[model samples]
Target chain A: MIGDKIQEMFLENQENFLIPAREVAHVQAENNLNHALLVLTKIGFNVIVVLDKEARVSGLISIPLIIEAITGVTEIHFDRLDSLTVGEVMRTDFAVLNDDYELEDLLHLLVDNAFICIVDNEKKFQGIVTRREILKSVNHVAHEFEHRYDVQLHQESIFQ
Target chain B: MIGDKIQEMFLENQENFLIPAREVAHVQAENNLNHALLVLTKIGFNVIVVLDKEARVSGLISIPLIIEAITGVTEIHFDRLDSLTVGEVMRTDFAVLNDDYELEDLLHLLVDNAFICIVDNEKKFQGIVTRREILKSVNHVAHEFEHRYDVQLHQESIFQ
Candidate 1:
């Protein structure tokens, strides 16, 4: 029964695992980097996805990029920090997963990324899957196992 | 009692909270970017600390950095990937926490950083405290409260 429960939680359909994009932190490519960083900080996300003019996936900006800008490591002119847009500072290299992606494949992407960006068939920006969310799901399933294990032990003791 | 537990976990002495440097993924400054990325992938870390010639903390190379390097967005020459070293692309701007740092201060840092580097006053690399580890600790404490609440509810129902 515990094995079945594990299968139900872990091996379930992909639709149940999709974290809605509304729960993720994202910024438009046209937005100022300064404003994006401010909003990103408030959201407490390690990385913020950048969406294009049509709300499609574009790139990502993270705390490290902010630090680089602050340290003058990047070519961003200090005086233009107020005007620099997300498109100029965000790294365009990122993996975009479709709605049909398997949880197993998503786990592989999470191994190298802080979060995975999901998009629809039309390239509409959707929600992201974060390691924290996945871990939270795991902890919930673990509690179920713990509860069932206690009941099993109780029944065994009564029979003895 | 929950407040006391929070205090015990969050306000306790710093020594108990150290995650140990050996547990972190690190690369030498002179190591090639190709090799560094390979090790980083194998270790499944979002970021890898770059150590200098004297084995002292130098900078950090994260997944985003690797992504940038691959995309040729950074100043690093794409043709020199094999010859390029971690030192060429690592971010020198990083916050280092000493052993005496308060958990509150560490939490503040972790709000934006995936992990905070810990070092001795001599600047010797210690370990890193990841957000994942802190969340896991919090979850453990939360379960205790949940168990107590459940038992209380059970007893009240029996009395009724």
Candidate 2:
């Protein structure tokens, strides 16, 4: 019964779980690795969205990708950071969700990914759903049920 | 009633959720940033543990920290990767859990962290509890509940 309730709650609040695209940090595909690294450092995020000229979701870029790009068989080529663009090394094989995606789809994807990009039918970026948001929502729901049922599910405070 | 059962299940299976330290990637404090980068690139982990000479958990290292160490006010110091040691740049302000840690503690911490290092009283590394593991466990429980109750809580397959 509680499982069904949680499923319903997740489905009903699907829209609220999304971190809108406007609030997410992103870089243009043409930007060099150096610029991408700067964006990652500035925003304190492990990965950032890469957008093409038309504002479509191009790929995802992260520090590991940059490191891999610069690393040679014998040594790291620091100069490549300036020469290589995000488009050249960004990861294209990432998961994306449509507007009609289910909460179960998100839960399954978030198990392997830190976040999932939400795109429209035209592959235009809409927003992101992060593991943190989902965890927070779960914690919130647990607390809500605790209050309604007058029971203790956990002793810890709500996740911030 | 179901909330209580779920809590009991989580607590009873706490140890199963941990990813033992031996499976985790790590670097020594004496290692240079270049070596750290190599380990990260090789292991496909965003962050790696840093150990002191005594094999105690010293800190955590990641690409952002490396980038920050190499970044100057006006330029990026590419040469610092060779010059700086992991000890000079690794982040010390990370969460660590002991063997007696509760499931609630892990769930609360995993909301903000990708993984929480498990350490002994002597600060020796024991294992790690990852967000992935928690998600998998939660999914497993949902499926178990679905099967027992003979209800269709979700339409999707179990998360891998």
Candidate 3:
């Protein structure tokens, strides 16, 4: 994901941020710009994968919603930052790195899932890796598990 | 942010991701890992700042809330991405950039708040730039406007 790194950008470009299902780019939580440019040129858009019903990655849709739906409306409210989408424009209180953690705990999930979240233990999504792919898998496992490891991978202890 | 470009070891050094509201790290919405590691070692924390109810910038709690609170448990229906927060975890669908647009539309807002807003229009914060800070401010304003051309900024909008 921009010259992979950060555990192969969350384990090999984590499905390029999943955009299939007929190239999604919705516009119905309200606000529409020619159907968000017809779902951004038929799904070649920047971001907008939200599904909603409580969650389904529940947030995304930024490409400035086609320049604030053709600019200057004066709506201003629902907590600014340019008329929030893709289901309240996600960032969903960030963080989510469980590909089975390692890579110095995926470099401490590099914060703000602006990239990284390849979960599977039912956390779902099973894809996403950026912060430039766990800082390129912590320089590829720092050659011999960097300084006697600090992670110790969740210290298991569940096997009884 | 990936050693500011995947540890080429600091791409000629000058990295920037400034933060100081006491080094952030302040979780609450009931996930409490010893009070989030004592608020991430008293604010020297790398990330984890999810605030809402008008506290401003929400979402972001790195290391995936200590790996889903040390391997999920609080009632097995789990995977609320580890009990969300900061107003049910951030990324409230964003796209707010009125720092007077047209810097290639703020360098394509580095494709979605580069990992959650950095804000400016009286929202304050001010220090949060990416797309690698708009490619290092387009090479420091093209080497200080190459001997100056009524310097303020602009080079054919860098390409619409």
Measured against the true two-chain complex, the DockQ scores of the candidates, in the order shown, are 0.05, 0.23, 0.03
Fill in the DockQ of model 3.
0.03
lDDT string for model 1 (A1-160, tens) is 1133333544443454567877666788788766775665455455788877788888998745654553433232334546677787788989778977755566556645667788889998888776656544444443443333221223334466
Over A2-77, each residue of candidate 2 has an lDDT whose tens digit, in order, gives 3665576545556677889899999998899989988897777789999887778889999888888998897888
For model 2 chain B, give the 10-residue run with minimal summed lDDT: B151-160
Ranking by TM-score: 2, 1, 3
Runs in model 3 lying further than 4 Å from the true structure: A1-34, A37-45, A48-62, A65-67, A76-138, A141-160, B1-15, B19-160
Candidate 2 residue lDDT tens string, B52-82 = 7777899999988888889898578888899
Per-residue lDDT for A77 in model 1?
38
Give the better candidate number (1 or 3) by DockQ. Answer: 1
Q: Model 2: runs farther than 4 Å from truth?
A: A1-3, A11-16, A143-160, B11-15, B146-160
Residue A60, candidate 2: C-alpha displacement in angstroms: 0.9
The candidate that wins on TM-score is 2
Docking class of 3: incorrect
State candidate 2's TM-score: 0.86
User: In candidate 3, what are the lDDT values of residues B50-143, reduced to their tens digit?
Assistant: 5544445545554333333333232212233334433433234554444334333433444444533455565543334444433332233223
Query: Which candidate has the top score in lDDT?
Result: 2
| Cα RMSD, model 1 | 11.9
Q: Any idea what lDDT model 2 has? A: 0.78
TM-score of chain B of 1: 0.75
